[model samples]
Target: MKGLLLRWLILTLAILAAAYLIDGIAVAGFPSALAAAALLGILNALLRPLLLLLTLPLNILTLGLFTFVINALLLMMVSGVIGGLKIQGFGSALLASLVISLVSWLLTTLVGNEGKMDVIVLQRRDEDHWE
Candidate 1:
């Protein structure tokens, strides 16, 4: 549950970052960003799989790049439902989606599944063996 909340917060931050970086994406405030993130998460969990399966051929043809289009559509849908979030057009949604995904991915990587910062250190215990 804590991990879930952490992930949600990360996504909310990502949404805020997207709003900050993208010209056509507007988030009214932090509350709106939180709501948008939650809705986007729900939609991604509930609807994305079906959409992906339905568009498998196109997705395959584009070597999975079409997933970005699906993501953009979902972002647009979220904006439509969230009163405080606004996407000017499909192009804006696409760019915003890219930004959101990138930010979310980067933060999530830093905060691993356990909801803590993950760091790896490598040391050479011996010339022949490293651990």
Candidate 2:
């Protein structure tokens, strides 16, 4: 669907931003970034839940910070599988994950879940008054 493609494009942009801002994470090019984003999306959808459930105690102990660790691991997994994407260390992966998550969240918030802008209209009613 259009929404899905928009989300994926946002994610790819996030990945590129992270790679640019971070020192140890390297993306060969836009194609690699696209592939990485797709792989990340698939992994997050298919594997993240299981990892979260398995690491619930740790996640709870860290007040959900361990979720970042899970995300970093997933990034590392993708790096291993993708030749053009390289993450030099766990620290790099963790930082990249954080950056990607933030950028993706910001972009998604701006784009909306449906990938379209919604307009809202408000009208004054008899029971309503300006403060």
Alpha-carbon local distance difference test for all models: 0.92, 0.93
Per residue, candidate 1 scores C-alpha lDDT tens digits across 1-131 of 89879988999999999999989989999999999999999999999999999999999999998999999999999999999999999999889888888998899889877877998888999898877
lDDT of 2 by residue, 6-122 (tens): 988999999999999999999999999999999999999999999999999999999999999999999999999988899999999999989999999888887766777555666
Collision pairs in model 1: none
What 10-residue stretch in candidate 1 is worst by lDDT?
108-117
**Candidate 1 deviant stretches above 4 angstroms:** 120-131
TM-score each candidate: 0.89, 0.87
Who wins the TM-score comparison? 1
Query: What TM-score does candidate 1 get on C-alpha atoms?
Result: 0.89
Task: Give the count of colliding residue pairs in each prediction.
Answer: 0, 0
Model 2 stretches astray by more than 4 angstroms: 117-131
